[model samples]
Target: MSEFETTGPERAGPERRPRVCVVGSGWRFTGGLSHYTCRLAGALADRSEVSALLMRRLLPRALYPGRARVGVKTAALDYDERVDVFDGVDWYWLPSLFGALRRLRRNRPDTVVFQWWTGTVAHTYLVLAAAARARGARVVVEFHEVQDTGEIRIPFVAAYTRRVLGALLRRSDAFLVHSEHDRQLLGDLFDLSGRPVTVVPHGPFDHYAVTHRPSPDGVFRLLFFGLIRPYKGLDVLIDAFHRLAPEEVSSFHLTVVGETWEGCTEPIEKIEASPYRDRITLVNRYVSDEEAKAHFAEADALVLPYRRSSASGPLHIAMSNGLPVVLSAVGGLVEAVGEYAGAVLVEPEDVPGLADGLRKARAAAGTRYPDPHTWQRNVEAILGRSAAAAEGGTR
Candidate 1:
């Protein structure tokens, strides 16, 4: 079980490599999920046949936020498949959930890995799992968050969503959780003590290749990027930045660049209230890949002092950019950053500690990841035994 101790090849080839159906937003969105799905599918293709299943339309055009397309306008993926399922646009009563199920049954993939995130898709994914199970394909759900931040807003909705998700989880043959903390959280969320759960560390964001060609300049700078949400504890980060002595504050500039959502204005408010407001820049909107690259290139460190945490996608981005991180040692972050000399782990919401952590990172040299996670290693970890099982079937 210890990957560090393994001396031989990561995999023992199967007579027929187990075909995988990785279900997610193939190229449909531009964020952590789509990036993860696209890269993972590509990596799996290196060892086994891999296909990406995409939703034609997540929501009806009338209800869609920006554009009602199957893909992000700025991104593209090589693998994409359509599910001809009939869904009721008005309510969850439509049998369209079976569309993906039917597609999986027809394909009869060796394993179906469902991208498990958001309660909004719980009902559909629950039914999809049941359908996949009925058709005899091994089901694996990769959980991003054991729970979502928005869940607290609607307790009743969250309760029902959890019930539906629990059913799907019980029906799954295997599970892939990002870290041991997440594995434990999944158990707390639902009864997973009986399921085969593997701690597959999320790979670094290696897809930012052409866009990753610059290093931070002379001025000490800190960057925060991603969708802005309340649970991320940006206010605490801003307050901590304010707590730094005036001389230390003058030595650095903080860049807050990310898309903000409804009711997540506390960070913005904190920025405006700070005496060092002139030194802070906030781009409260969606950023392009080039823009993201530039931000990372110029940042001495990426700061993420979250209120609580799980496996952090932003942490992966920071590592891929080779920027040191000043992060709260909550959830899986402490383990994910794993002995990276550049990481400065601090107490969540501890104003003085966060300030000190940021100061330390200013003088710190970016460290290499002690255990660099790769999608190839992740795919192998999930499917190595399955591949051997596939070979046994041939025998």
Candidate 2:
């Protein structure tokens, strides 16, 4: 029998849900995109017949920044049981790629949603996009960033990406972005004159907030979490911490928890040389969900001083926990957290402004129940009729 010939028990609904295939990084690679892939698949399952085709191996071990833990089981998140998942395609393995193509045909999805972050998967995406289109499926590419900072630094890679992404975007039927800022960047970089582009808010990463507990210590704890890369502006955060008055510094403690990436060591060096080093705790490694939960639980506020970003996973984690956040206003981050009651936006790279924001965050430190973002709204915006009918190409 053909794969599509087999039918499961009928679900109670007004009509049969559309079948969807979500393509993204798998848990084997274990990063923000992997988490987002799983979460999105699970959410889509609530309203669609969902299948996930994940990238198991993105690149060669030597070239990967997180090579040491490439295949390690570091994530606690998994896909919904209702969603069919293929653990996935590899960058260099032709057999794995063939298997993914076969899976796509077997699933016969109505729409294939591709997660765009790095150029490493462009070839694979182009191949899969063609396969999906051949099967009469609409293709939707969700833009995570215009171009990866690390990838943009390499001239050849940048050139290759420009050609490949241009082709892929031309073939795509629709586009999804996290914010209007991202929509503008997409328009500026590519020609989307008649394409349907919808702005969807990032869903809450609240699954880890079950471990929330207030700090027993009297000190007001501040956290700066996520990968420590050059673009993350960790050095500016260090400088902001130092600018705090002696009395204010005495009342606060800063925790820097993240895996070092792209050899960005200046922030760590600054931390080691600081006069108030005793007040800072640094966990310079990628941590498990349980460990991350513990970090959020003991913290009074979360601070992310990014020089540039489309969106942030850590910021969503803070919002889910209702933890007060002090974020640098840049890129899509400003609109992403602007409405949150506990958010204090400061100018990017402004050390004094960050210091002021930190003070404000400390003064307003307390849990605010009910996170604003939801997966249901995100799902609706991506597949709903309004998204298809959006005006002037993007909404």
Candidate 3:
């Protein structure tokens, strides 16, 4: 209610529903951020007055790898017409900031939900959030990750990124996190002893699910999904694939799906060049939704032995397809794997442990996500009167 509130009928009667503006990576046809923006915005539109302000490029061409633009070229806007989309935020252009801000001022949404994941877009978001706060709109930051999960080899670069994320968190009025680990991390990183941070689980990626299919021949297929990054432990998984017993290695085919970013696939390619080359299939590109669905449908299990992560969408995607997951015990993964019926959790980078987990996959059952996280509950926790009960969830 700072400076953005209009006193009378402007805030009531015909437009009684809460006006929500979601600004983030839009229409990414194959990735997590785009998937999240589309799903959450569509759900919000059902109960609230919602519109999405999406960025055309998350990073410059030089910065992004394996793709020309961030999103896919689909005929429909944001994969659905129900959710209103303003699909023109070019991060490279400074003028785009003013345009987005002008739209915010003219439209004046009650809540401006800015998606925060990487520190690269911090400066732009900081200015935008400040303007929204000045205009009296409550700014709710949905943190996918407090810091970028992409492996940063440079020490100085990593340090600066953390500082930028801390600044952005300070600017936001309330926070919407997906897990308790993220909620605790937010409190420890900033001075939020009793802040309004609602912990809403990520909705099931049920949209990605397809009818299950048996593996090719007799070989068990293991899928290591998502972008190739150092932190995701792809190298470790590849090494484990080679180190497996001859009979064990012969029993399975590893499907390494996803694009290699910033020239990070050398190690994976090296492993593929080894004798295990015949056993591992490296798909180095962004996959279409239909392609992704087919991969999940046939795969025996999804392995994500991440070095670090706040929460996981790939895990949810696997569960949605009723696929058993074999992930490392790190971040919110401990809590996430527990919700699934037949997931195998091992120590991060534990090569032998991961290898053994893969061997155990033959006996694993297709998991059941009995209670999927609903978007209705997520939006309500952010805007309804029950929001007060979701607060004070801090260390």
Candidate 4:
């Protein structure tokens, strides 16, 4: 046998790797948080002793493999292994908060990472952070969407989220945000001076660089991929598509991928039954990874006309696949979708603005897409700083 074939796989030389535990809501499939967790775990696995504690409701066997080798301890609420994203991370299913606390205390991780977004895991995070702190473990809280616009009409839930998040933030050792806007929001909302904050841009997927078969014809295909929520501004996209001339409409197509949430389907159904039906394609369901790739492959550009302000994972996915984006200037969308040659920014919730953006995006189609290097560099900087801190180094 060749030397490569004869030798066992090369092992990372041991230097007392720091134990790191990642806590998150769910990790079943290809949503934003799941993708972020998987990527972060993979990146840290190469250098540190990494494990993940996922919620039982979202555990998938397929999603997590090689857990035994990687020391993944999955904690779920049930006995089912129906949800798994990838392998190589340890898992503990249906584990109580107290059980998780005991495990953390026993493992004595060097750092405990928490991923927060919808506030579902808020109480658990607070308890875990306290547990980790008692053991001298550094706590890192990564805010997927921390900015509270204070525009939420639901006062009770908003108030509860604010109170819980404030407590979580105050207890965390370090805060990781996706944009400067989020950093500023953190500073405004909580006492964050003592706990340093770092900005890390979302990274592109590995498959983004894969060779994709282009759409057979040169029709300008506009794609809206992700969960169909009211805030996504689908109404604006529909209005913009409707305003196109007959010939223009015939020459273009809009594909709405992913299912509707938050009563967004009513308007979508109205659009589907209207005169502009033929100009649009509604693949209204949770898009699989393969399906998403095919849609991106067949599209000329991705349109993200969100009404409310927040960062977007779809924008990063689109840009990573070399699909230029036309996005509304709201919250961190502008920061994430920088003014690259392939990006077009427009006013939020303006039908005419979206229409004009569409025109410009179509006009700019076939141009070189934005470089992913910036995202890579930003992620590296964040991880580097985190690693340095873990190793007793300065920022």
The TM-score values for the models, in the order shown, are 0.84, 0.94, 0.87, 0.80
Any idea what lDDT model 3 has? Answer: 0.72
Give lDDT tens digits, candidate 1, residues 274-367: 8999989999877666677677767778899887777777788777766779999898787777746668899988989998988888777444
Clashing pairs in 1: 28-71
What digit string (tens of lDDT, one per residue) describes model 3 on residues 1-395? 32222232345235487777887775542358777877888877777777777776566656666556445553122445765677656667567766787788776777778887766666667777788778777778888888775534567767887776667667676778877888888778788545467776677677876787886587788999888877788888887787787777787888988877766876567665878788888887777767778788878889998898877777888877777788899987776656566688889999999888887776674444453456665666655535434322322
Candidate 3 structure, TM-score to reference? 0.87
Which one wins on lDDT? 2
| lDDT score at residue 286, model 1, on the 0-100 scale | 71
Residue 86, model 4, lDDT: 20
Please, what are the lDDT tens digits per residue for candidate 4 over residues 27-141?
Answer: 3333566666666665666555666665433333443222221223321212123222222222332435556766676666666778777644566667778877777766778
The lDDT per prediction is: 0.68, 0.85, 0.72, 0.64
> Where does model 2 exceed 4 Å of error?
1-15, 385-394
What does candidate 2's lDDT look like per residue over 250-327, in tens digits? 989999999998899999999999999999999999998888888988888999999999999999999998888999
- Alpha-carbon shift of residue 278 in model 4 (angstroms): 1.1
Residue 306 error, candidate 2, Å: 0.6
- Residue 394 of model 2 has an lDDT of 42
Q: In candidate 4, which residue ranges exceed 4 Å CA deviation?
A: 1-15, 28-30, 58-95, 147-151, 208-210, 373-395
